[model samples]
Structure formats: C-alpha cells, structure tokens
Target: MQICGGGRYDNLIGLFSEDKGKDVQNKNVPAVGFAYGFDRVIEALKMQNLSPEFENRKILITFVSDEFKDYCVKVVKELRERNITADLDITDRKVRKAMEYANNKYKYVIIVGKKEVEENKVTLRDMESGEQKFLGVEEIKFE
Candidate 1:
C-alpha cells in the first residue's frame, strides 16, 4: 500500500499551455508530495485509546450592538485566517445574554462593543480561567 505519495516540482505544461508558447520545450521539473492514511491512523490511535488534551476547542465572539457587527465580522475573519475555530453571535442578543451564552459554550469569549470600536480595542476573556485582558485592535495578533 502506498502510505504517501508526493511531488515537489510538477511541470504542469498542458495545464498552462495557453500561457506557455506553443514551441515551449518540455522541461522535467523536480517535484515531491505525500498523503497519510487518515482512517488507518485513526483506527490505530483508537486501538491504543489515546486521548487528546483538547477535544473540544472553540472561540465565541459577541457584539454588543448592531453598530459593532462589522467589527465582529472582522474579528471572526481574523481568527479564521489564523486557523482558530471561532464563531460570532448574530442573534441580536443583549450583551449580557450573549456573554452568558458564550461563557457556557466556548473556551474563550471576545467581546466587542461600541466603546471598544471607538477605542480600537477588544476584550478577551478566558472562560476557564475567568481572566480578562483588554487588547488594542492593532495589538491583537491573529497568527
């Protein structure tokens, strides 16, 4: 069974023929690539009964008002760009209710309010630690 297969420099001449001149010489390019048997790996791990540290990881963002909805979208986009599992509350819930929901549903809660928007900052609360920190919008690192 091929456990993995890969190529590093695949010369996709035919695919880019429109861009390549008709008389373009065929060049042999160096290439490498690979893929793991995910199902097999999962079965092996299951047999060993190994558990990961964090099985459920998620972040929740709550916007205090419609005016800050755009900012909420921006924050969610930033988190997603960093490969973080994040969701924004778009139910038009009150700040307190949204915060309560987030505290119950996610490990982290990012609160963005009108004041925060005006100040260009966001408040990050650790649901498990109950610790909070205010970070400038520009200071928040996505990646």
Candidate 2:
C-alpha cells in the first residue's frame, strides 16, 4: 500500500531563488523527489467494492486447549511473517463455534492442540472441502 513518484526538475532552483521576500539570487539546479501515501490507498480500498472471488486467502489458527495458546500465537506469527494472511481465536470459544467462524470467514484453519504442539505439527483443515490433515510447520502449504 504505497505509491512513489519522482521526476527530474531542471532549472527549478531559479524559482526558489527568492525566499520569504528576501534578496533575489540567480542560481539554477535540477531537483527530484518521491513520496509514498499509504493512507490514500487504504481509503480507495475502503471505497471500492471488489468481487468476493478476488479476496485473498485467509487462515484462522484455532486452539484446542488453553495450554496451547502461546503456540497458537507463534504459529500465527510465523504465517504472517511469511506474508500469509492469518488470524487467531482468542475469545475462549468452543471448538464448534471457532470452526463455524473459520468456515464462514476463512479459507483454512490450523488446529493447534497439545499433541500437535508436542510433535511440532498442526492440523490443517480446508474449510471449503472439509478435509483435514496433519503437517509439520515446514510442510504447510497454501493456495
């Protein structure tokens, strides 16, 4: 979410030779500059109504027990660091409710529990296909 633009401005210094009504000076030089405005891009995204089919893949990390909360957060962080869109369930909700939310809003869900954490693995579920599989962090894949 950034835009940068710059161009050469030859003979532009003469225009600024007189500053604050001070004594005018005779000089000239080329100038170039660039600026990035993320706020404007964010505003445009909010205003635009894109098709649902164009949405990016979303992953939800759900915990099987409170004991694995830290591990769940770590997994989410790792995914995000890899530029993967991921979220975590921190509301202390039941598995059924969490799965429902993930199925509705996320494309995939990674179930983290004691066993998975102990084995340094996670249960990856494909929401659309209702298919599930166990995979190590290094074995994880995305669409």
Candidate 3:
C-alpha cells in the first residue's frame, strides 16, 4: 500500500533538455523526485480523521467586466499584503456563476462593477450572514 514513491533518476539532467530554447546539456547533477497518490492519501486522511478543517477566511473578488480588472487586482493585492487570503476570479464567468463558485468556499465576496469602478468602491458581501455593503476599497475591514 504505497501512497507515495521517490528515489533518483540519473538520465534526467540538463540546463534545458526539451530543446524549446537552447539545449545546453549540463552534467548529471544528483536530483531526487517524489510523487504521491493524492486521491488515495486524501481518502486515508479522511478515514483516519486527520484531514484539516477549512479556515473560511478566504475571499473572492468577482468583476462585472474586464473594465474593472485592474481595480479588482489592486484590491486583491492590498488584501494579500495585509495577510488576508484573497483571490480574483479571472474566468470571465457571469457574476451569478462567480457567486455560485464562491458559495461554499469563500467567507466573503467582493463585487466590482461599473459603479464600484467609478467610485473606487466595492460591494462586499458576507456569505454567512447574507449581508452586503458598498465600501471604499480602503475601508474594507476583515476579521
């Protein structure tokens, strides 16, 4: 029941072997690699009750259009700088679809639309309480 395996490979070594760029063949440097059976390991963890709990501190930023992409990215960067787990939805999905995707995974959702862009504000929605408010990007507070 090996959940993971690793050792060494001697033939795999080079500066750029795929020849995509310059194939500068270097000496065989000692390297080791390992891989895990991710699905099996997760199942074992669940059975043993060793899986970690969700933190629920992550927030999702969804935009109405590409027009607000820059603003949304800036907001995300600010949140990350403050040590908050923030992610931007770049899938070009509709606002409703984005909300559905963030439904159970994120604690809050920051919606950036035309109004928010023009006003330098965002609509922050609490997923748990179903409460929302329009706030300036700098005014968004996190727990």
Candidate 4:
C-alpha cells in the first residue's frame, strides 16, 4: 500500500541553530505542506470493485423532417465546436425513434423543425425532467 503522510514545521528552523560549518537560519519561519497517497486509496477501491461515477452532459440534435436535417446538422456542429457532447441522426430516423434513442443515451434533446429553423431557435428538452423550452443557439451553454 502507498501509505503516505505530510506536515509542516515552521518553528523547526530554530532547532538547527548549530549549522555545522555554514551560517543558516536560527529563527522560526512560516511554512506549509501536504501530501496525497490517493494511489493506495484507488487501489483499495479497485480491489473492492468500486468505481466512481462521472457525470457528463449529453445533447442530441434531432430533426422532425428531412428538410430540417441540414439545420440540425449545422446546430450539432456548432455545439460540438463549443465542446459539447452533441450528436444527431444521419440515417433519417423517424422522430419517435430518434427521441427514444436520445432519451436512452442523452441528458438533453434539441429538436429542430421548420418553425425552429425559421426562428433560428431549438426546443431544448431535459430528458430527466421531461421539461422543454425554446432557446436560441447562443443561449445554449454546452461548454
């Protein structure tokens, strides 16, 4: 096990007054320190088959019709450029199937349709809460 510990000793400088041959500090000095032996902790957790959960924001850009496909693709590209974990269907899947797939894997779903494309906005849906709202592309904080 990678057992480790650490501390600071400010007054410890004064204990070294006998400098052997060279002149050194004989007064207390301010100090601080810390150490991490998390390798051991991680090893123990691994032995128990324990794992940490990671939360990732997932967004799927879905379109209702083929006409909106181009717009959805554009929006998806923009989101990805902003470092968002966003994707869209390239197989021209039906809206129902697209939504089902999104709900299974994504935390958010952005629906692009004729109206949304014309309005330059999208219907952002929260998969977990089933709540949705219209949002401008600039308003989406994927980063």
Candidate 5:
C-alpha cells in the first residue's frame, strides 16, 4: 500500500548540536528533497494522449577537408552507436555546398572543421528549429 514514496531530511539534531564551532552551528539547516515515478508519469501522459512517440530522424555530419575526414568518421560512428540516424559528406563538397546539402537532407547538422578539430569541439545546428550548440569533443559520448 505505498500510495507515495519520497525522501526527507531531519536536521533537528544538527540544529540543536552545540559542541561544534559557532560558525558551523549557525549554518542554514533547512531540509529539502523531491520524488518522482517516471513510469507513472508516462502512463498518465499516455492516458491523456500527450506522450510523444520518439522518432529517429536523420542527421548529417559534414566534414570540410581531408584533414578532418578521420575525425568526422569517428563522430559518425559515435552517433550511429547511440542509434541516431546519421550520414557523412563522402562527396567532399566545399563548406558552403556541404552545409546546403546537409540543410536539405537532414534534420540536424554536426559541423566539424579544421579549427574545430584543433579546438577539440564540434558545432551542432538544428535545421528546422535553427537552434545550435557547441559540444566539447570529449563531452560527446555515443551511449
């Protein structure tokens, strides 16, 4: 019969303790916490027809030069490992033309260039929403 379950903090003991230094004793000692059942939330949303069916849309990872081709391959491999639909510009088009092709073909674009490779980062741009984010090379994990 678990109607609800959550965590709480009991700071009364810490608040009343006097043996510790006055500076430590005077610290703010309010308790705080939260609880959530994601499964229940999903069920509720489904009942309301508000749950979105996640779709795997294609993304394009464009490389501007032969120098960055290997890095581009690595990024493509990482994206695919995450089950993300992705492709690369094997055509070796110019930067502007590649961007054009990506915009037309994919929902999102991951741009990797010489300077980006040197800086160990990549730029991700959403074609439809026009939003963008720059991610550090190491920060991106496939899984």
Candidate 6:
C-alpha cells in the first residue's frame, strides 16, 4: 500500500500566497507537503498482522451502586494515568450483564460493591479464566 507521499515543493507555498510567485512579502518560500492514506495504512498493517491488540490490555469496571460513581471514576482516572485502558460502567444493567459484556471485550473486569468500598478493595475477575481475586485500590496494577 502507498500509505503516504511527500516531497519538497519550493514553489508550493508561493503559489498560495497573495503574490503570484512569492511566498512571503518579497521572497519565495521553500516548503514540503505530505499526505497519508490512513485507511490504506491500516489495511496494510492488518495484512501484515501488525494491528493493535486492544483486548490484551483493556479492562471494564463495574460498580454496584450509584454512590460509588466518584470512587469508580477515581480508579478509572488512576488506571488511565498509568497508561492502562480502563472503562467504568455506570449503566443500569445488572452485574451479570456487565460481566457478559466485559467477557466479550475486555481481558479483566474490576467489580466494586459495598463490601469492596468498605474494605477499600476491589474484586478483579479474569474474564478468560473465570477467576476472581481481591486487591486493594492502590495495589491494582495493570501496567
């Protein structure tokens, strides 16, 4: 795929200037221009088996109550700061439905409920293995 093309164009800028052949007030400007075929680049990467593996690092967060929205948001913010892809689910869906959604898209699921809030911990579930473990808020590390 021809992903991109660029080359020097000394008169390119000059052609766009108010003066017919002068890029600046009294002089021509040497310039270069480039364009990328983003779709073609993505196709090439897919063909080369180089596409991003988002599921490997993506996580879904599910909280039990609306009261814990702030806490969940804080956790999500911290995870993002660490370069971890985290998503907080505050929808009205049941926990089971949320887990199902996570299983389809994320590698891990963080579940926080009243017990977890009181204990300052979260239940982490491995979506692929169906395993769950408890970890402190500060102890969770994905990166």
Measured over all alpha carbons after superposition, the RMSD of each candidate to the real structure, in angstroms, is: 9.2, 9.6, 5.8, 14.2, 14.5, 7.3
- Per-residue accuracy of model 6 over 1-143 as CA lDDT, tens digit each: 68999999886665677777443644467778899988888778878888665447788999887888787888889888877778999799778999988877899999988988888788989899999999975677654
lDDT of 2 by residue, 5-76 (tens): 677887677776756255434455667877766666545566675423323457888887899999988888
- Per-residue lDDT for 2-108 in model 5, tens only? 33355656565576677456665555476766666767765667677774432225777887778898998888887778767778888858867877877766777
Candidate 1 residue-wise lDDT, 25-139, digit = tens: 5543545667788766655565667634222447788887788989888888877776567888999788788778876778778888877788877898878898988886445
Minimum summed lDDT over a 10-residue window in model 3 is located at: 19-28
Could you arrange the candidates by TM-score from highest to lowest? 3, 6, 2, 4, 1, 5
Give the Å shift of residue 81 in candidate 1. 0.3
> Model 4, residue 33: displacement in angstroms?
47
lDDT of 6: 0.81
- Per-prediction count of colliding residue pairs? 11, 0, 0, 0, 0, 0
Identify the leading candidate in terms of TM-score. 3
Candidate models: Cα lDDT each: 0.72, 0.77, 0.83, 0.77, 0.71, 0.81
Full candidate order by lDDT, most accurate first = 3, 6, 4, 2, 1, 5
Candidate 2, residue 81: how far the Cα is off, in Å: 0.8
List residue ranges in candidate 6 displaced over 4 A.
1-53
Model 5 misplaced regions, further than 4 Å: 1-56, 137-143
Clashing pairs in 6: none
Tens-digit lDDT string for candidate 4 (38-81): 77776666677664321245788888888888888889888878
> What TM-score quantifies how close candidate 3 is to the native fold?
0.68
Candidate with the greatest lDDT versus the true structure: 3
RMSD of 2: 9.6
Between prediction 2 and prediction 6, the one with superior lDDT is 6
